[model samples]
Target: MTSSTPRRDTLRFITCGSVDDGKSTLIGRLLHDAGAVPDDQVAALRDAEGRLDFSLLVDGLLAEREQGITIDVAYRYFSTPRRQFIVADTPGHEQYTRNMATGASTADAAVVLVDARKGVLTQTRRHSHIVSLLGVRHVVLAVTKMDMVAWSQDAFDAIAADYLAFAEAAGLPAPTVIPVSGVTGDNLVRRGEAAEWYAGPTLLEVLEGLPPIAETARPFRMAVQGVNRPNLDFRGYTGRINSGVVRVGDAVAVSPSGVRSHVERIVVMGGDLPQARAGQSVTLTFTDEIDVSRGDVLAAADAPLEAADQFEATLIWMAEAEMVSGRVYDLKIGARTVPAQITDIRHRVNVNTQEKLAARSLALNDIGVCHLSLGQDVAFEPYEVERELGAFILIDRLTRATVGAGMIRFALRRAHNIHRQAIKVDRNQRAALKGQKAAVVWLTGLSGSGKSTIANLVEERLTAEGRHAYLIDGDNLRHGLSRDLGFTEADRVENIRRAAEVARMMADAGLIVLVSLISPFRAERQMVRDMMPDDEFLEVFVDAPLAVAEARDVKGLYAKARRGEIANFTGVSSPYEPPAEPDLHLRTNQMSPDEAAEAVIARLRAARRLTASPPFEQPPLT
Candidate 1:
């Protein structure tokens, strides 16, 4: 052992492989042999075979043992004289790949297991690729059940070579491959004579001999978690140092704003510290009273964090709902939460073949390269530069559940170049001249649901009353703006996107824009809502049952869709996700188009978008 190098107390690692690969047995043997298990637990270790039946795993995980599945991640603890270790036992099934990523996110190393009979399976490649993506520094490949193969070195060497090649292509570090029998406890804690041909170190020796992380190599970076102001005199910023170190008098800067200051004091719980390194949560007081907020980042002055509003990232879709391009989701990056959208999906990776395949969206457990546009500029770095600053989780606005994970590769080259040009006459000024609050009245529902008729009536009434107004129908847009797009999922998303943009432009020109379209997905409508400010966008759902709409197929489109002539027709082959809480709900089934138009007019008046009354104070339509 290299005693000169400082050792860390715990090595957080994980055991991951295909199902029935002896991951549980390997961990059980290691824990028992390392003297981490209690005598009482050992008494109940074996099954009817008088052998270690590690078929049962971590506590609270026995409920799944009957099914021989690990649905969630289970953390197990063990120790040796050299160092203590925390091992995450992760599920290996394909559906639970997200759970595996959860365990590997914080792990320093991964013990990738492979059954001697199965060699390297798809799960092996996927787990290893995720490990590489998550920045796990080390890997120890344990080929378990060596007794099944009679401890053949040739089989081990062949499997090792294949895995090494795959890992190299997948951007993973070369792993240490060892042959071991989890059932017989061979070559786990000590070397047995089974594989005399193998002259390398045993499984435990490799892990014990591996060097602990002893580098504070990156520039200092700490995202301000909160502004600490207990009393009047003490106003310090509290956060954990993500990298490097900071001491008193050290020059530092705030990100996204180039405000520089010097560290006056570093205070911990007990007292002030001379200096604080990575992993230390300390309260820092600066010499100058600088502008700081919850989402701000404090960093070394010479190496301040970069800020960007657009980025290129790799996304791992975890939610069952497929990822939709042009949809707005909340992306939490370190201390900051920003409204983010996947502007484009460049491609998705085939984990087994390591091939890049063209894709419009990412499904559950699918990995894709995507472009993200944030609502505002944020301090961040590439994943290779710093994990804490580069990694982010995507949250659904409605459900508030984590839907996806992303690693920032780099900011888009054009993100820094393209800046918003200022216009002297802005939206508010234009709206003031028109004497109305310019807004987009979006009408959404099934096809042939009277959306277009209501929108037309509303447009005529507004224009007749001397208010400048515009109507953008989805079918009319196909004539030019979205002519090239088709009826596929991606095409529909683009169609809606184009209509929303046109509505936004018309609203900017001081016109009340009325949009009539069957923007199928709720996410697509939400994207439009995000594009405009509050009170400037009104979602008017022309509610109608699918059967009612199909019966009233004025354009015969629904009849064609039912005949299987149209592949992705919404309400037939494709799905239409209705708005859960629309700003104005007009049930077309009970009300005529005239009444629906009147209701929309009333809503517009109530919302103050239109200060003028209708053409002649029109009576209720009969």
Candidate 2:
């Protein structure tokens, strides 16, 4: 089913940028000039005495008033006769980056404020990155405080040029830059006469002419947000229709369970509705007893939904905590929450320059590609096709905090894959089988410094001691688990991520897992460690000199690395900073293999991980 008409008349836009960029002042001017604000509010602005304490107009929070900054995303509703506007004034401080994300996440367009005096700063680039990442279709780079630069067209042009260059590099469409004086009410709703050199539509005129939200003609797709059980006799699946249309008597498919049935009835908030189109929140009753619940999307039989356990997505890391691979978090899409693990990080985008940075892990406000695997198969549509079903949020299970936001690019697994294993055994039993408690043993070192060899030795020793053990060697893992990975900084992050997950699973089974990886970056290694319990995790450093490592390169990786066969390769092409603190350190070059193994054994014994005595210890009895 499809609906060709647009339902909403108004368009929503958000203003985002670093603090003191005059976002609030610009918004206030727009509202005042458009006659959207009430007479009383206008009087308040005038009484505040032409100084235009713009923060007072929209900064609703008392804390915001005290701090003279927008603390939260403040929504201001106003309308011109031509089009309605709902403006979200987002915070600018780096600490409130997540708040900025929350604001722009739903906007059709964004007004990215840049100080003309300061030009484009790092925060300006960051906000632009976030706007593009969030799928904001239109961007207006409102260069504020032209009065600071004496409304100089040359100054405005210079800043505009710099921003344009950066935006092109960041993969964002060239933004329309308007040189405006927010405090003086120039080039906002009304074109001020000050900019004599410029002959362009005013900011409000441009905003008013933006294309209305386009309607999609895709098949009927609605994700069940909640089960509406008003009484014992009535059972309905409630959610907003993501695309197309839904009507009674239409054949539908329930995913990921894939049960087929006919739509018995369509119900709206008021009562039974004749039909529901995209963007309308409604409920539906099916003819058969399908095992449908939250997280499941219903689609027309003609265009059935695809089910997959893994998918690739573009993500904006909004948390202070870095995005590391193999870390498990709850993914919330629509009304569904599923356990998810990041298998790989593809690359980080440099927003201003639109260049791809080789990133291992994404810090706060970083944008990257990630390969994600759900705990179970779920139905999803590509973001380009259907944004409602494709967008997701990563929530930290422990803190219940949203750490990242994602948009599905494509599904990795097929719908009919039956190789997926269902949860059967208890975790306690699995842990008992492994000798040591299951925990992630994160190994970080330089390439060719013996991390893999030492990890192999450790695993062998644990296995011989009758303990279950698993080895997630960095190289071997890349063959299958991270086969699609590369050696870029971002790729390396994903590589460690997949390895970390395998290690996490082994550790959960109470296995003495050894991860021998030259996880050169400190931030990435710490992320792996954070995923495991304190007692179970061991950060083992395989310390050796660059010369020693190069001399012992059996794989010729060092040789190739020196010749630059690989870029961002640790110890050769890239820098490898050894861990300042580690659970255990073994100078493999100084000590023999046996001596190094004994040292590991000694450390494990001291940690109460092993009962075996050192070789020097002898039995006193008999």
Candidate 3:
């Protein structure tokens, strides 16, 4: 323990699958083959008799023992002369997906087991998708129970090909697939006669040959995990160096405050060191008196670091509730936790086919592209460059539960772009000048059914009353702001998304904004609501029967849609789901336009949205 140099040859791997996928048995076989298990444990397993008592080796939990399945991620430490190993046996059930994510979060590689008879199931594809999403670069597709299929090469090859195709379609990096029989112990530790036709290294041989991570080539970055104060004279910042190398007297910058400092000393727990590299947990002392604290990261000055309040990222939704935009959560990155919200859902990736789908909200176990706005600027690197600093987890603010995992793709605002702009009036000042608070009035209705007309009328009235109002008319916006957009379900969703976000910015500037378009989807409207505050969101359902809307079709869009010239056009080729409940619903066919406006204005006043409206004067009874 006192040696100046500590042994640094540990391989962290995780075994993941759905329950009854034989994860425990595979782990037991590996431990037994590697000679890592104690002699007593081996003897017990051999003497236990009946039904392959392999569970006795690692299933220490009483629930696991009785239930005959792993309930939690079990960690087992073992070592061979060449390398040390830490294996995490993760649960395979759908309900335990979070547990599997936890177990595989920090692993350098993952071993995904598939039952030979079951071939590739939904869970198999799910686990593969998860492994890739979690940034596990190396994957070993271990096809278990080959003996059940008589060690048939064709069976193994077919499964392998299917999995490979699926994985490719899912955008997962290519994985190495190997067939093995855990029960008979063939091709686990050594090559066996049962797999004579199989021409690959045994599992142990492949594992042993896995190259260790190249820690030195990366950029220097160490997130301050905690402060160490052994004594008054020994105050130091302790953290694991996530990437690159740090040496004494090396110049480093502390982000996101961007404080420049030099390393005074590097202190390992056992001894003082002149240098420290990635993966080493050491305490660093800065020469200058700087405000360095937990969550701050030290990085090389040449490359510096990326710190941003907004970022574009890829997220894998793990929660049961769909990922709604603007919902605040605690983002845990490295050793830091910061408030964050999903500003937008760019698109969702189909895990099975790797196709990008326009998604309003990400469902459970869905992976998607999202724009995240952090409460404060945070230091991050792209996952491709630095896994430790680039990856983060989203925790529900109230429940303190981890809901999603993410990887930063690019910083929205970098350090160089942090300079203050030269503007006379800022956003707050602009809001104050508008008299009435700015907000988005998202109106949804069928084509030619008075959405645009009402929106334009609302904006005109608000402007005439000295309120700074803007109308992001759906058609007009599509010609400019959303010019590239179309009318498909996805395109429509995207169209509304762009409009809502722009409306939010304008509203933040104290304008009363109105969006008038035929946004016929309920989900799309809900997405807009999520992007704004409850009071700020005003959903007006312009209720008109399809017959009326088509009758008044000045653009002949309804006729075109009926003629199959357009696909997914609401109320003609596509289905239009009416709002079950809305903040304001107006039957345009029965009421005059002025009466409808007055009704909406009355509701807004009741909600305290209008500034100068007299105390709820009843309109003259007609």
Question: Each prediction's Cα lDDT score?
Answer: 0.87, 0.80, 0.80
TM-score of each: 0.94, 0.69, 0.68
User: 471 in model 2: Cα distance from truth in Å?
Assistant: 14
How much does candidate 3 score in TM-score? Answer: 0.68
TM-score of 2: 0.69
Which of 1 and 2 is ahead in TM-score? 1
Choose 2 or 3, whichever is better by TM-score.
2
Clashes of 1: 0
Off by over 4 Å in 1: 1-8, 48-50, 55-59, 612-622
Off by over 4 Å in 3: 1-8, 43-51, 171-173, 228-235, 413-622
RMSD of each: 3.1, 9.3, 7.9
lDDT of 2: 0.80
For residues 1-622, write the lDDT of model 1, one tens digit per residue.
Answer: 5998566577889999888788777887888877888877787867788766654546346556777777788888877778778888888888889899989988889999999989999889988989999999999899989899999888998899989999999989889988998888888888878888877788878878777765367788888999999999989999989989898999999988879999999999899998999888999999999898888899999998899999999899999988878777999998899899899999999998899999988999999999999989999989877888889999998789999999999999889999999999989888877777898999999998999999999988777666778999989999989999898777888789888888989899888999999998887888899889898899999989999999999999999988998899989999989899999999999998899999988898899888744334434444
* Residue 56, candidate 2: C-alpha displacement in angstroms: 1.5
Candidate 1, lDDT over the whole model: 0.87
Worst lDDT window (10 residues) for model 1? 613-622
**Model 2 misplaced stretches (Cα beyond 4 Å):** 1-8, 46-50, 413-418, 421-622
Which candidate tops TM-score?
A: 1
Q: Candidate 1, 126: how far from true, in Å?
A: 1.3
